[model samples]
Target chain A: GAGVSQSPRYKVAKRGQDVALRCDPISGHVSLFWYQQALGQGPEFLTYFQNEAQLDKSGLPSDRFFAERPEGSVSTLKIQRTQQEDSAVYLCASSLRTRVEQFFGPGTRLTVL
Target chain B: GESVGLHLPTLSVQEGDNSIINCAYSNSASDYFIWYKQESGKGPQFIIDIRSNMDKRQGQRVTVLLNKTVKHLSLQIAATQPGDSAVYFCAEKSPGGGATNKLIFGTGTLLAVQP
Candidate 1:
């Protein structure tokens, strides 16, 4: 794709269920990032990946949140035992290089019931 | 609209008028700065960006002004339109520069264009 692509534009998960969201970055992009945006809030940083290496996971709110970019091109965010507070728009972005402008995906709106 | 804590102060402008949004970043060591526009229920879309070395950068119909002294940033949009109505965010990625990235962002500001 010419741009970053994310799956399941909208996801509805029952509390305590596990959900996984996927991101496909632009081809050969070396940097990928995950962010969580709450209603009426700015997107908060989650984790960052340089190719297949996870360099930062400090922004993750809980241990239940996990992310992996096995090949550096595609990534996934998994939330285990979801809670209502976890509901938000999960965004994925990729940049040709870091510190440059990043391309953002459409984002997945996750709603926990 | 509800305001986010990290969000920048908002500016309301009339259609065909100019709109200005501002940001104050806490990190002075931050080397790169960017602006993003996000509509409701969507992710942020790239706006324009300026590096610390430069005081100004411009894009079509948009301009970015940076002041290192006060650690402030601003986005200027000429002839604001209804299509320009959305939340604007300012992001900073610091000295650990390269593809290894993390952007600390401001909360965002909602630009309301009155016709």
Candidate 2:
């Protein structure tokens, strides 16, 4: 009955450094999503995965942002050469099916100094 | 180019009073809408959802009303509690974002319940 969970609840990195954030979706979930939330703003879509296949990555801002869900359960979002603009809360969510209600993780707050 | 937005950025209500949060969406193609509550230092929590076909849905102390003609949605909470204080967001699921069911979220409304 555990919900989705993300690792490195808080991450601090110097500008130009690379960082990787991890997510563990709920067991048996087939659909996974990643979102980025800026301060005082709503969460924005980043990418999506249906099982191990990356169905969509349009939400990613640039090539520096990469995500992979190799096993259909664990996912990783990596950002290369961190920028101050990338400082935000990275959220991960999962659902039983597309369009269904999603369970969200606590999120990994990444700060680029 | 379509987006979701809240009519108000902040809402304050006394405890035990009814509260209403309003949202306006520009994507008419959107077929599903959801409400989420997020507290500080946490991720969004699903509250209730309403399909496009229906105008109204109720869950616990929360009720969601959808107005397709005006492209608007509203969440009504009965007897608001202090615990309900958080950022409330309205999200719409529409095609053509990243996948078949991409959700576009609205600017959240900070709900403050006074005890």
Candidate 3:
């Protein structure tokens, strides 16, 4: 079975540019989560979705950050006006409906210069 | 503001030796704990998990122990291998939220296996 996967394993963007990171969760997974991991640090929760509904966006750092999961399958994390501070690895995870055990993706590393 | 943290920044052990990684959490109300292994250039991979109800749980070659009385958690790996060398992190379920599934992760401990 295929695990969660993210696209554009590496990305380099100029400051103030917009970037979109995509995640494909496992088939039939009902829960999806996004996290940000800075260098030498653990991942921090960013947002969460249950099916197509966005349930929690509390962890998003700023208004420039946005996420959506329409059709209950694929999710996207978009960062507008990228900043140097936003340079980090963005990780996506999925789990069976509301379960605590989450399967993670390889993550997309975004480097803002 | 509760947080999770590791006791050591790095641990080096010989291959085939037993390895133990320690973690401390601030929230006593946290009930669920998990261990994850992350290699360079990859996301976290689940190793094992234990709930507050159980003091200990085991998986293939890996074991997790939870001490609720002291708000401590530990991961034990038997007969460590080079493939097991990576960053290990302990995570706890968020205590008070409608979205309790969100996890609070600790600063990872790097496990270096020397053959």
Candidate 4:
């Protein structure tokens, strides 16, 4: 209810299956982010965390794309073999620092069938 | 490989008029600038932020303008309504110690609101 919540909003993966996306921020909100939206393009930066410490992932576009925030408020963005350009929409944001202003969720479309 | 542009991708306003969205950035040691509003499936809603030493910034009705010597950035929505439509992004951040603040998005400008 505070904000930032995501999980299985819609996933169809099958190409090479292996998908796990979940984010639940907005509690302590140190900092957590993962973005990748490509249906019209906008969000990109696909990795960042400051609480559970992940630092950066160079924008993960390969290596099967993986993300974790362990306990800093919850975060996980896995996508093993899935293809089809890895489908689209997959976002999760939260900020209380890093210059501030950020709180989002409602994203997780990923469809690679 | 840095980009964030929009000479215009789509912008049709009418409701109450007054809407200007344009952004062009290529990093000049960017120092924070944001304006987002996406509504379709939801996400991105910040809507105003400016700092590169601040050229202008006003919220609520929305307003953010940062020039940073020509890097350019703008977003102003006064009366435009129809829920203000959606898809409008312009973000950038760089110039810090870095643990990865990374925010560099732009390439969005679909704000069709006519009523």
Please report, in order, the local distance difference test score of every candidate based on alpha carbons. Answer: 0.86, 0.93, 0.95, 0.85
lDDT measured at residue B69 in model 1 versus the true structure, 0 to 100: 94
Error of 3 at A77 (Å): 0.3
Lowest-scoring 10 consecutive residues by lDDT in candidate 4 chain A? Answer: A95-104
Candidate achieving higher lDDT, 2 or 3 = 3
Better of 2 and 4 by DockQ: 2
- Cα deviation of A22, candidate 4, in Å: 26
| Model 3, span A36-101: residue lDDT tens | 999999999999999999999999999999999989999999999999999999999999885798
lDDT (tens digit, per residue) of candidate 1 on B31-109: 7888999998777999998989999999999999998898888899999999999999988874553445677667889
- Return the clash pairs for model 3, or none: none
lDDT (Cα) of model 4: 0.85
Q: Pick the candidate with the highest TM-score.
A: 3
Order of candidates by lDDT, top first?
Answer: 3, 2, 1, 4
Error of 4 at A56 (Å): 6.9
DockQ for every model comes to: 0.75, 0.78, 0.84, 0.31
Q: Model 2: per-residue lDDT, tens digit, A34-64?
A: 9999998999989989999998888999999
The lDDT leader among the candidates is: 3
Q: What TM-score does model 2 achieve against the real structure?
A: 0.98
Between which residue pairs do clashes occur in model 2? none
Share of true Cα-Cα contacts across chains kept by each model: 0.72, 0.65, 0.74, 0.77
Query: What is candidate 4's CAPRI-style docking category based on DockQ?
Result: acceptable
Candidate 4 residues B28-85, lDDT tens each?
8877878888999988888778878888988888788888888998898999999989
Model 3 regions lying over 4 Å from their true place: none
